[model samples]
Structure formats: C-alpha cells, structure tokens
Target: MNRLSLVAVAAAVFALPALPAAAQSNEITIGISISTTGPAAALGVPERNALDFVPKEIAGVPLKVIVLDDGGDPTNATTNARRFVTESKADVILGSSTTPPTIAVSNVASEAGIPHLALAPFPLTPERAKWSVVLPQPVPIMGKVIYEHMKAHNVKTVGYIGYSDSYGDLWFNDFKKQAEPMALTLVDEERFARPDTSVAGQVLKLVAANPDAVLVGASGTAAALPQTSLRDRGYKGLIYQTHGAASMDFIRIAGPAAEGVIMASGPVMNPEGQADSALTKKPGLALDTAYEAKYGPNTRSQFAGHSYDAFEVLKRVIPVALKTAKPGTPEFREAIRQAFMSEHEIAATQGVYNWTEKDRSGLDDRSRILLTVKNGKYVPAM
Candidate 1:
C-alpha cells in the first residue's frame, strides 16, 4: 500500500509502544502490508493513502496501525504477517495490495487465527475463510458482469491475456466458467509476468485469433501492456479489462489506447452512476470526497476505496468483538474473526457486504459496475 498522511496517522505510527503487556491490552493494533513499490505500486499507494483518514479509535479503544511494505512479493508479505503476529500482536491484518501477496497474508492470518481484511480478492481455502474476509468483489461476481456485458454487446468469441500468476489464472478460469454458459468461446489465451515490459508475443497471438473481444485479466499500471500493445499491433476488436485495471493510472499510462476499453470494476469509482436510493451511494460518495480532498479531483481509485472500507468493516466488527473479549489477546483475535463471519449487511464505500462462515466474500453483483475510458476518464458503460 502507498500513503501520504494526516498528523493523526503519523502519530499513530509513532504510537506503537514497546509491547508492554498492559499497554497492548489498552490499545487495538492493526497490521497492514501493502506494495508501496514494485509493479503494483500504482494500486498499493492509494490503498496506503486511504488509511490516513481512518478513525483514531475502535470500540472506544485507542487504535494503533502499523504498515509494512511488501514490495509486491509474497515472501515479503509473509514476513510482514509473521511480524504482526509475533511482534505487534495485531488484533487484525489488513492487506498486501495485490493477489499473490494477499494469498500469502491470508494463509499466515489463518494459521495464526487472526482476522484478516484482505484488500485484494484472492481465492480462499476453508481454513483461510475462517480467519479472513475479502474487500473487493470476488472473481465470479465481477466476471458475471463482464460476461453479461459481452452478451449484451453481441460478442461471440473472446481472447485472453493476463498475468501469469494466480490473478490471471483466477480470471481466465472464471471466464471459462461463465463464457460457456453465456455461449461465448475462448478463442485463444496468453500470459505475461507482472514486471514484464513487453507482451509482444502474447499480443501477437491474441491479435491473430481475431476474436470479437480480448479480455485482459490483469491489474494496475502493468495492465496497460496488453492494452497499448494490442492497439499498436493493429488489433481492432473490443478490449475488456478486469477490475484490476480500473484505476485512473491505467488510463493515463495506456493513453489513447485506454479509450473505449470495457472494464469490470467496483461501484466505488462512479457512485453517481449508481441508482438513487442505492445503499452504497452515500458512503461511496463520502469516500470520494474525503479521498479527493487530499489526492486531488479525478484521482480517486477503486483500490483506495477498498482500503477506506477497512474502517467501515471495523466500525461494525470491533464493537461486537469488544463485548466478548479484550484487545491484544488470542481470544480477541478469534472474536474479531467471529464478528467478520457473523456481520450482517454492511454498506461500505465499495458495496453491501453480508458475510457468513462458509463464504468470506459476501458481495453480490451490486458490487460490480461496467465502465469505459473516455476523454481520459472512466464513465459508466451501458
């Protein structure tokens, strides 16, 4: 995650006392790991920045937040999670900005039995599900919107180019699942690493297939690769992007290539486009106003909205957890996990969250929106 902050947040950084047992008991600690550098920085920085605006206290207890840079590396994410458990005694864990690192963080939180609020959407195992909740819409939920949009636009065949990691695998696998039901065929598929500057080989292959549309299952500025290259290579078919590339940075980086590209994204990016009386509109707009106040207008990010929603999650769970257990204890962590499992319809900046024991990601299609880049901005598509 990336950040520039208010004084309260700076002071919170300085507030991590030496772990004196009594001091720890009187305070609640949240450990966050985000990629402030490396390939995913464009997504992580805004996530980091959103933290500055969080409440200074939770459940009437002083809150201490500690952040570590995972550098988009799962190993570093693991290290950060272990430190949260063994050192800071974090009551909960927040994130590592992208999927691979989020998987690492979730596993560590699962093993340690700490509640983890994952900023990215990652596949969860049964064990991980008990301890973690994801902030973003799950692949299937967002993929359905993309598939439906494709159906509406009369797309018959699709090509895929995505990150070679779990993120790519999840999207491609989900697309295969949805496309078949929607009568859309996957004409071809290709993959590239997150750090790769060139996807020429993959773009060339996808361009050759000449499907009705090509889906880029990638995120952040790195996603611009397939976007720019596909255009440069003279592929004129429609381009569809996963929610990961919904950030404005992707539009800027991809420039003219970004225009008319369809995106599967969270409703946070365009709250005004949401129907009136929508539960998500008020909070989504609130986050936009607060975030843009510091970051500047038209700079709001979906990733940052995920980060801001963490406090919204806490506002509900912390009070319930506090009634059962005191802060800084194993019981308290377990209680936080239970609170996540039991919390009812929570309307945050992103969407309405209604989680349960078996399904840690509770968002429905209401969390998703379709957008297209136009005139250097994202606007509702369809």
Candidate 2:
C-alpha cells in the first residue's frame, strides 16, 4: 500500500470529532513532551519557548503547561506520556516535534481519552483515534504545493532525494503522488542516512537524468550532504530543497553553491525589509524576529513558525474551553475542539487558520514562504 495515499485517505476519514457531554471546571492542565535535549534538540527548544508563551486565560481562568523531555527517543516519549497523564493529571497533551515520539505518545493519549494537540507533521492515524489533534502542516499538502510551483514554471523532470526513515518516506511518497497529477516526472530518487558525508553519487545519478530541478528532504547535519554533492558535481539545474534543507547549515556547508537555490518553507523570519507584506506588519512579527536573534541566525526553520502556531492555537482555545466546560472533564476537551473548529477565519502570525474535517492544518499556499540563499543569507525568492 502507498503510505502517502493511505495518509491522505485516513486524514480525511478521521477529520470528524466526537463531541463530549457537559462541563467540569477548575484549572486546566496540559502536558507538553518535546525533544529539549538531543540531536533534534534545536527543533524543540524554540517550540518550547513558543508553548511557554501561551497564556492561562481566555475567560480569566488559569491554564498550565507541564513539560517533559523525551530526549528525541520513542521509548522515552511513551514513558513521559504515561507519566504526564497519570502524575500530572493533564487534560490535554501537546508536542513531540519529531514523528517517532509523537506517534508513541499519541497512542497513550488516545487510550487514555486525553485530547492531544500535536505539532508533528506525520499523517494522522486511527491509533490517534478520537483524542488527537494535528497542528503542523501535513506533508501531503506540501507536495501538492511544490508540484504546483514546478508545473507553473514548466518544470517536468525532477530529482528526488531524502532521509531513509518513516518521515522521509512519508514526504517522498506524497511528492510523487502530487507530481503525477501535475504531469511532473520523477527522474531520480535517492536516500541517505544520518551523519552521511557523501551523496555525490546520488547527485551524479540524478544529473545523468538531466532533471530540471532537485528536491532535498532532510534536516540537521544530514542536510549538508546533498548540497555539497550538487556543488561537487557542478549540476546547474534549479534546486528546490524542502523546508528541512533551508537551514543556515546548508549555506555554511555548500558555501557559494548554495546561492540562488529555491525552496518551499514556512515563515522563518519576517520579510520586513524585503517586500513589506502583511505578516511583516503583524503585531507578533517581533516574536519571530526576537527568536532569530536569541537563537542565533542558524536556528531558523518552518518548524519554528509551525510550533509557534501550535501554541497559538492552544492559547486561543484554552479560555473558551475553560468558560464553557469544566477542566479535566470530557466536556472541556470538546469545548476546546469546538472552539478550534469554530474559528471561522483565524488571523495568525503564520497565516490564516481555517481548518475543517477535510484539512486539519490551516496553512495553505499563502502560508508558505519561497526562500533563496544569497551569499550565505536567506532572503525571500520572488
């Protein structure tokens, strides 16, 4: 079975919610488990900061976030999920930036009947069942968007390479599905592992196919390999990296070769000085700007915008849930879920939030940012 197609089908099927009865009140407790200290630690640190900013009030009630570290391990995530649900007595759970941990914790959240608002982008499942809510932009939609851009530009033959894992396979399969509808051809497909130094052979293979562009879908230290490979082989095709490869590390790794490469990503930094868009004028734009400054320029990605949006969505629902239903009760969970669904036209820092049974993630073509690296600096691609 095609995993990507299954994801699309399942996401559609699981979109409906089962509303709970009556309200129970008091303090609403939420649990957050993220990789705060590990290889993927940088990804969650900013997310933790964003979740920390969620206020305890919607209608003058206190909402508290209890954080637990899973250290980027699935085992640890399961352990922490149980601890948070049992010891913390949380009504809801949020986080696990990476997919493995998110999947592990999601099982626990579902069996426990505790509502979970997740930031991981892996396709939703029945195991996530009734108590789960997805926060990040799902990759299947991202693939469609990328294919649109490619087709609009008359790009047909394309190269594909990604990490060898569940997450990578998830993204790649979707990219292929969308490409078929758009008349795009997958000329080459490659895979790599963590800490791999050379993808030069993969680059050489893809270049042999004479692809019009290349899509990179790996993150962290592994992101460097392909960029370096493209450069070493001197392939002149247009480069279209995924948001994962849009890191500052790519520029540092590939140096001059990284320039003029186009990629689809979520809002990383405000385009204040570039084109003066509405996001630049947004009141919360300063938060992202401050985040870049605090974390150093190298630590920015679509995940930051995504995780920030996750926290923001929770923040918006907490108060409404508290006022309408009692905390720690099934009614409270239903209220929060209803509040999120009822947000007809949500104005957010990332983009508008308009989720439904069809699409759990509100981000569409508008929320994505097209980026290019010029002289080791990331700037908007127009």
Candidate 3:
C-alpha cells in the first residue's frame, strides 16, 4: 500500500504542468508615480494610457502595476516613491513623469535598493546612477539639435521663458551651454510657475527685449502658456520647445499659437522619416502602431513612448533576473538593477539603450530629431 501510494503521488506531481517560480509568487509589482493631475498632466495622461500596452504576463509571470499621481510635485513624488518601496514592495519603480519628480523618486529608489526607470530626462548624477535609468534623452544631446536649428535660422539673440522648477533650470542650463558655443546670445530669462494663469508679465518683458527667437523650457500643456502669451503680445519670432512638450495635448491646448513651433524630439514622433535600419525605427513603429490602435489614429506621443520604453526595459531585464533569483526577494531586485547597468544596445521606442555604470540615461544625439508643428501636426524638420 505505501509503495503504490508514493508512486501515484509522484506520478501525479510529474504529470502536472510546471509553473515558473514567478507564478508561485503570484505577480511582479511595478510601482509608478506620474504627474496625472497638475501641469504635467498632458504628459502623464498619455504615459498612463501606454501602460495598458505592457503585457500582463511575461514568461508565465503576471505583472501588477501600481500607478500613483504626484501632481507634478517633487514632495508628492517622494511620498509616492516611499509608499511604492515600503508598502507595495515594488520590484521596480517607473515614473514621476517630469524631471523634478523623477529625481525625487530616484532618490527613494536608490535608498531602497530598487531599480528606477524614469520617464523624464534625468541628468544622471553619480549618486542616482547607482539604481536609476531614464527613458528620455538627456538635455545636452537634444539641446544640440535645437542649437543647430537656431544657428541655421540666424537666431543671434534668444529669450528664455520656463517653469520656475527643476525642469526649466535643467533645460535653461543646457541651452546656455550649447548657445554659448554657437555664439547665440541669451537676451532675457523669465520664470513662471506651471499653474500660473498669466505669463503675460513675462511675455511683455521678453518682447521688450526683442530677441531673435525664444525657447520655452516647459513641458506638457503648461509649456503652451508662454507661447500663447507671446503670440498675443505680438512677438513675431521663432519659437522652440524642448522634447517635454512633444504631445498632441500641447497642440490642442496651444491651438494656432503652437503652429510653427519647433521641438527636439525622438524619431518615433515622425516614424516615416526614420531610416529602415536605424535602431529606433522598428521599435518606434511598433509603439506607434500599438498606441494609435488603442488611443486613435495618429495619436502617438513621445511621452507615451517613454512609458512604453520603461516597460520594454523591464521586459528585457526581468527574465534575466528570474534566471538568477526569485521575485519578491532582495536578490531579484539587485539582479534587475544590475541587468540595467549591464544592458547593451537594447532597442526601444525612443532609441537604442546601452546603459553603463557611468551613463544611466543611455541615449546619444541619434535619439533626437528636429520637428515642427505644421498644419496642426508634427512634421520632420530635418
């Protein structure tokens, strides 16, 4: 009786389909803190929408995504990050859609020894490099694209109007560095809060200065405010924006005022113009197809691509992490973090990522392209 019973039990166990260790743990949790309610809402909304495209199950392991709204505030982002690490026990954290909030969450992820994939353009400081990587291209790489455009257009003097926040400061600093080398003078600098209803005062000051062109260092629909004000105040000059405002919402909010506005953005925004063999081409088209299919025809945004790329990075790393360690464990988190650090030539919707110990934001000049708003659509400028 004992021998037959043992044999039956062993046979039954062997007959059952083998489940992955991740299946036993139930799911892999990914914590996201994006700015869905404040100035960055235009950017965050699409990012939230793109998460729907992330596969629910990867290699037989279900994924659980926990998203929080930070309202574009750094303090709120920090709190959300702490909650994600302590309460959610997230294996990885992705978000806080803008620079300041992303930086705040990066601090928390580093402290908690978890991997963070920021959807914003992070500066990649040595401290944050330990556990953080960014989806958006860094400022200098994209700024050079804008700088060259300005040079071609004979923009001798430029005015600056940006949010009174880290995002603004970062872009302004990068522009300054690039502008100097190109012999472009920055005539005026004005700061405005994201929620400010009146950039009129700043616009007046900028117009009075009479610069050859103006670059607005703001993001999402909020970036439109200054441009609208400038147009209303009759400032007939070239308008340039950063990659942050590369969304349909910006155009809808800015209306005709956004027309002719130029921005440095990823090639995904203009997929047809991309070379077939380019690293970004295939992934960019895939994201564009998936996003437009769900959202609508021609509704893709670089912000959404940023979120999709975050998921792609996870998709590439988690399987490798699982090979070495189980989910919901410290070893697994470390493996994921190390995977990002060791990644090489990984294609994403934005660009090819080749992360390293020094460069967490693994993008170069190839990640950027000049785009212009024409006929209410983004067309490749170069």
C-alpha lDDT score of every prediction, in listed order: 0.86, 0.67, 0.83
Candidate 2 runs further than 4 Å off: 1-26, 56-58, 126-129, 152-154, 195-201, 249-254, 271-284, 296-300
Best by lDDT: 1
Task: Give a tens-digit lDDT track for model 1, residues 1-382.
Answer: 2222222111112122233343238888889989888999998899888886778887668787888888899888887887787777888898879999999999888877788999998988898888889999899998988888889989999999999999999999998787877899999999999999999999889988999999999999999999999999999989999988888899889999998999988888999888888888988898888888988988889898898899898999999999998998887888888888678888887888889887788888788889998898898897
Error of 3 at 267 (Å): 1.6
Which 10 consecutive positions of candidate 3 have the poorest summed lDDT?
1-10
Question: Can you write out model 3's per-residue Cα lDDT over 1-382, one digit (the tens) per residue?
Answer: 0010000000011111222233224578888889878778888888888877777766678777788888888888888887766666778898879888898889888877788998897666777888888889888888888989999988899999998888899989987788877899999999998889888889999999999999999888888899899999999999999998888878888899988998888877977788888988887888889888888986899898998888788778888888988778778888998888666788888888888887877887668888888899888875
Cand. 1 Cα-lDDT:
0.86
Weakest 10 consecutive residues, lDDT, candidate 2? Answer: 2-11
Sort by TM-score, top down from the best: 1, 3, 2
